[model samples]
Target: MHPQRECDIQAAPTHLITLGAEVAATLSKDGSLSEVLQICSEIIAHYLKTTNVCIWTFDQKSNTLTRVAFGGKDIYTASLPKTIFCQEDYLENLKARLLPCNFRNTPFSSRLYTLVVENNLVGAIILFGKEYFTEIEDIVLGWIANNIGLAMERFLAREKQQNRGETLLLKLASKLRHCLDFNSILEIAVKEVRDLLQIDRCHFLWYFPYCQNPRITITHEAQDSNLSSLLGDFSAERINTLFDKIRNLEIIRIDAVRESSLDLETQEMSIDLGITSLLLIPLKTHSGQFGAIACSHCNGSRYWSDSEVELLQAVCDQVALAIDQSEFYAQTRASALAAQAQAQQLTQALHKLQHTQSQLVQQEKMSSLGQMVAGIAHEINNPVNFINGNLIHAKEYIEDLLELLHLYQEHYPNPARQIQDKIEDIDLEFLLEDLPKLLSSMRIGADRIRLIVLSLRNFSRLDEAEMKPVDIHEGIDNTLMILESRLKGSGKNRSIKVIKDYGNLPKIECYAGQLNQVFMNVLANAIDALSEAEEKFQIQNMQIHIVTKMLDSDSLIIRIKDNGAGMTEEVKKRLFDPFFTTKPVGKGTGLGLSISYKIVVEKHGGTIECLSEPGKGSEFIIQIPVRAIASFN
Candidate 1:
């Protein structure tokens, strides 16, 4: 709205203004690295009167240069590969020296500038032209390089913050997933957030805006051991003249509460309590906002960063979700209890009806989900198979092309200057050596995807949901395949090897789908326990052994044992109890083992038992009848 910028370069001073303004404008758009490079390259090339401008990032791990974006005529020509082979002697020399170098006047006058970030060579900016750059032009190029480096740093920081926020949210959701108790959920939410952010004090204040009492009552508080607790009620009526504004705010951050425009009493209280800064985020869901989370900094007047604010907001969202889930559970349990108080006959009738209805609903949902997975797998298989089928031909075509190029080089060693320069620019020698490796990598990736698709089809087993004589080992193997990633461990968990000892046995008559669910839940639990034990107790030798065999030829037995931090007898007693668990509030819903028990004992006329003691690992033994008591059509 203010003014429009001219596209042409005017004077030396004007060049600086134009370059600065263009780079600033591109950066302000916050598009992507490609857009920034494109705009900057155009401006730099225009000012320097260069024919071409390009940026190639250096990959230190592979010792290669990847061309990110470029601006010029014939930029996408076949004379160059997307990746510049850094094995070339010219590049080796330039990289070793870490300095700007220009080529002699041959096909064109070209110069290469190193883009260094934090003493590490991150990239290269190449400018090609008929005329070399003047000293003034070099100065302008340096200015552009500095701006580009700073912009890249900013972008990288932004990406890291975004990734961290995502990880934090995922962890919060996972930890609170099994939690049903309102108080327990609140405790975990406050403690998790306080520990993660290293905040001095974190408290959840319950408040209902619609109520006559605008009182903020602290339900839960997590603070440093040295810090005094603030777990009490406080009135908010006089706190803000515009209470609606505070209620609707995404986040209310006071960097220096002592200097803030908060009520005089609030400011005085904060100063007296040694609170430098504070952040209040309203906990909200689709239903309503019933509370706010207060995070305080007591050390000094801390500047609340945008990332920190976002993290707190995400944590508040998780808490709100936990609250909503807790309320839903309470309502559902109340309804079920009220129905249970009817006449004995009616109560039994209702119980059977509800159980049958629930079973039907669960089966329907599972069937629909399995159908969707099968459909997706079918759609993906065809395309992947097509790629795999043509992959060998691709390799053959590349080999033939390489052979032809080799023949050309052998016959005509002394080519024209233009052809020779083109060869060097394209780094054809490195390409010939790397072409097969690239093809092999693609083949490996395709094979991995195909394996994942196969695993999906095996695990779902939608057709085998009804009673059928199926191989139990196949179900176990499929579950293991799906859980392979968790077993291999990651940044936060330790790996555990699964030892399978299967005695040759005929296919057992049972519900294959239900048996598969049991295997998944049991195996998943063992892996989770081992992972937690690995981090907490620093246990290096973690293992889970699966043994299956026919017991007296009438029944089949399976024992799943793990060398993890064992549970006490008390835990073992309640291990199969419904809605009872030892896991953290949100981490477990206590239904996995219960379902497994019902499937093994009630449905299959089998027995399930858990044996464990402190310091000794837990073992779950499941025995099922092989010969069915009912006839199968």
Candidate 2:
């Protein structure tokens, strides 16, 4: 080599060092990756007196170059493309010869410098200038390129770390939003912070802000298994410095307790608790409650990064809001429970009131009808008995008179003409033949009247005020007799047939009057159902079947079924509810089945249910105890 050229190589270090110091100052400043890269490009462009300078970071995984920063004259920078391929035609000649070359059709020549760290390409810098680079300039550019590579690597690592912290903080916030329990929220906050920062222990300090010289308690703790617990209570004065900081809503970070500018006592106390490094993030909720989270390092001193501190502070803020909401919920829960219980009680009382009203109305109607029927029966019974008794004697007298007339007719062969004319006028022989038949018909009519009086008296059961042994079948039969008018065909309506399947049941001890009322209600409902069906579908052969059977020694079942239009499921569900009816307003009172259910189930300690389906039929099954329980009676 020539002597001057060789000397220039030795002189290159002094200039390179000056340029390197400028680049270092730019990298050290607090700025984002792109900003720092732009400043670096500007510094290099000024030193070279170039037209333009641009930097592109290369991603080895993608094998692509992405333009990141630009500096130099605005006129030249505006025309530059934001990205280009590493193997583009313009770059191929530069890569092959490792020299400055004209880029595309531009008048100025461009030099491509690869920025490398650890002998691997991380990025490239391009410079546009009129003059080619000298040997010393090339050496200085290589040094600057290496510094840029190192800066890019450091910023990339920091960005990745920040992204990770952000992800964890987001996860913690999402979990806190779903949590309602106070202690659980605190536990999750501390545990997540500890795991995110990889610390030895984390705990929450709960304090009341309203109290004078407030006290604090370590309410929740999350730590490594090998560490001792920090669960305890302390007076406010014990850690006055910490309390003051929390009151101010300040974060306290101590890299090493021994080296921190804390009071001597706090330092010693922290050491005693085996804390080499500590970070405390204070929280103040909207309701004025205050708390703090303490993250500690027990094994060795730890450097708490800025990113970690920021993430923990964010998590603490979310936790404070959750605690405030949980406290409000706790206050409202008791009132909610009380209101629910009161609602239940009111519903039950209303149901009882309705039942009592229906019972009173039904009893009044039944009592009035029974009294009228009894009065009519009594009035008719006495006269019918009188006529029936007299007819027996009258029949004998008529027979004797007829026999004497026949004897006279046989003995007096020669009768006067006047006697014969009188006989023709009176029709004597016809009278003798028809008179006895007339008396017989009168006796049968009186007997029918007596039978009807007996049925009316049986149905009323007014004499039996208390429960007594009664034939269940007799009460049912009486109810049928009363409803006979509804059963028979009239006009266009078809007759509803009655089918009875009586079982040999023993006399059951029950309230006969009330039991009879139940039979009346059920049979009346069946007749009404058939009547409606007759109009709608004109059902032929409509029938109501009365089935009775002894289920066992202790109980008996009475089933009353009708082959009429059945009810829907929704109607069946509320079938026995009081004042619920499908009939026209005046046609039905709607209390029949409800009253029957109460009498059978509540009064007699029995069960009653209706089985029904649409277009099929409905069946009411009532099961009563054989002997009435003493309490029910």
Candidate 3:
């Protein structure tokens, strides 16, 4: 009652404390630690009436206190120390005491000093001017320190929680990387987020291109029967609107799901599901858009914290990346498999085409042979008919002459002078000797005609029967017979000498008709070359040598050689190619050697090759397998 204030030290107002309480409460309520720190610094600066206030935090790596929060102008100047506090300046002192000391005269000097926690010195709070310090000033400084320390502790705790959540998200992302199934990964992501964030409901929706409506609903913990039924048919318009809003970095906070009238159907469905709050985040990929993740909270109103939104965004990014990678891998594998299948199909088609082409070529050869057979038959008919008629007339004439000779013997029993003279004139001894020789010659001519006809028929062996046992000698003989006229020199010139050196062989199972064609082609070519050379060189010594031998129980070998102008290496190379020939265009069809090669090698499962040199001659060797092929029937 007797106290009279010397100085105007008025009692601090309750409203001032109330205002500080309100400011502190507002700062503590903020979701972001950075904003909270800025708000704390503002409160401190306003209360202290200082031109500058700086908040610093410890940097463990640099062992320094770095400015984290600052208020007022030009406080962060160019000439100030990079760090206001350092371990070299204060760490030793800190190890020995709990309170920070002022260092005004030392290199690490500051005007303000404070302790944050025991053995965990946070940082120094710096204020300019020491005259402003007093009892009330210290109280204010203590309150500032206490408030900042509390805020920092809370901020650190929140940071650790956020880090743990990020770590779990990364682990989930790693698992999602191994998975290609979208639904399974989505389920895992939703379940993890629901449990980790402590939300009541979590659902995922996938947007499909060109689809009018696409949505997937999920419920966690509790399900409303009506809501469960209506979830499947939930309107996609709400999702679209939500996506458009969030795509622009706008946060959509629906504090009360029941109160939002924007999507009536969604609202009703949420009410049915007993959902009080819902947060939906869009899932986007690098290329384009994917869909969205809808997380719901039941039982009470829900506010989406800033950290949760950040986590959901991260998870959505991870899911999008994983899905994109999976789709890429799936498409690549499919394309590879499709290419392989196409290659296999092309290979099969090529094989069939080759087979059909071979068959067509064989048929063409047979047609050519048919035409040749008809021509040869027409040529042989005239000679055959002449020989037959001449032999018949000659037989009658011989019989009548024998009877006349007997009659003459009876009529002229004793020789008269005229009769004896006539008989002497006739030269009876010569007639008797010459008659037998003339008849034998006629018979030989008839036999020759018959043999020629038989050979012609055998050469055109058209029977399409199964492979049968065939005599190689017969085939060679038939070929020679058909080629004999060509072999003999035309217009009374010297004939080619065909030297046959045939070894003893057994009948081998083979397509006789095809083998006959092979022989005919080889022998005909040899005769033609030899004759052409003989005519060209005017040298009559033309020769063709044919040799046959049984190589083994399973094979037969044939060689045909000619002493004619040999083929060049270039000609030899294309000798077996269809439609390739050295002969004049009209003289050869160019298919003879090609067809011969096919018959000897492909049809008979044998080999045909040539040996020749320019200025020498040409030789062709054929080796045939004698084993019978199994009948397809």
Q: Residues 1-633, candidate 1, lDDT per residue (tens digit)?
A: 112212222335666767667877887676777777778787777766677777776777888777776766653234445675566464556533322223332466666777777876677877777686766566656666766766766776676666766776787798778889889888887887787667799888876667787776788999988988787766765554324544775577888887787878677766776788998888666577668888899987878788888888888878888888888888899988776666677968876675556456556766886788799888989999999989999999988988888888899989999998998998987887888899999999899889888877877887675677888898888889889988888886667888999988788888887888788889988887788788778888799999999997798899999988889878888787666778899998676777777788777888999887776777889998886656332
Top candidate (lDDT)? 2
lDDT of 2: 0.83
Question: What lDDT does the true structure give each of the candidates?
Answer: 0.76, 0.83, 0.69
Each candidate's TM vs. the true structure? Answer: 0.46, 0.81, 0.50
In Å, residue 157's CA in model 1 sits off its true spot by 0.7
Candidate order, lDDT descending = 2, 1, 3
The Cα error of candidate 1 at residue 155, in Å, is 0.5
Residue 244: error of model 1 in Å? Answer: 5.7
| Deviation in Å, model 1, residue 627 alpha carbon | 51
TM-score comparison, 1 vs 3, better candidate:
3
What would the per-residue lDDT of candidate 3 be over residues 1-633, giving only the tens digit for each residue? Answer: 113321212354454465357557865685676577666666666665555566666655666766666654554334344364454557556322321333233342233554366566666566543244555455545555666766777777678769878886888888897888756777777777776777766666654444566544332122233344223444455555554554554545676887765477667756776768877777666556546677776677887878888888888778788878877777888999999999999988885675557558767767687668756766786787787778778878887897888787888778788978987999976887788788788788877876877776666666544678888899889888877777776785678888999988888777787778888778888877776777777655788898989888888889999998888999999888766777877998677788788777767778999999976889999998777645311
**Deviation from native of the Cα of residue 606 in model 3, angstroms:** 8.5
lDDT of 2 by residue, 58-84 (tens): 777776777788777755555555655
Candidate closer to the true structure by lDDT (higher is better), 1 or 2:
2
After best superposition, candidate 2 residue 567: deviation in angstroms? 2.9
- Poorest stretch of ten by lDDT in candidate 3: 1-10
Off by over 4 Å in 3: 1-19, 22-39, 72-79, 84-123, 153-306, 313-354, 374-460, 471-506, 515-626, 631-633
